[model samples]
Target: MSEERETPERRRERLRQEELKRNPAGSIHGGGLPDLVGGMGWKFTGILILLLIVGFLIYSLFFR
Candidate 1:
């Protein structure tokens, strides 16, 4: 067989080159704020709400 076998390093380099080709130089990483919000979505909202509730409870218990 005349085909050359790809080694691990070669495979990694190939993948990186392919990624670079797909993503242009001007393109930014991730989806920025909207992407983060969408990815976190309900989970982040629920956590923040829960934290606020717990903090209020703690404050009320100690200061009221």
Candidate 2:
């Protein structure tokens, strides 16, 4: 029986997979904040910003 040889691209991909398995957070940044914002759809983001602006206006009118 002949052993299968891995191609260069396959070898590179395999090494990357092994590295990821060893260090799952090898490419993480900002500790999940980016993930949270990315998962929020544009519609939700728009509504959230609108609500914040309205709340700030109300607070300024009453407290300032």
Predicted model with the maximum TM-score: 2
TM match of model 1 to true structure? 0.38
lDDT score, residue 39, model 2? 55
Cα-based lDDT at residue 52, candidate 1? 86
Best candidate per lDDT, number? 2
Q: What lDDT, from 0 to 1, does candidate 2 have? A: 0.68
Clashing pairs for model 2 are: none
State the weakest 10-residue window (summed lDDT) of model 2.
29-38
For candidate 1, which ten residues in a row score worst on lDDT?
A: 30-39
C-alpha lDDT values of all predictions: 0.65, 0.68
Q: TM-scores across all candidates?
A: 0.38, 0.48
Over all chains combined, what TM-score does candidate 2 have?
A: 0.48
Model 1, total clashes: 0
Query: How big is the positional error of residue 3 in model 2, measured in Å on the Cα after superposition?
Result: 29
lDDT tens digits, residue span 1-61, model 2: 1226875545655666688689988756542544455556669878988998999999999
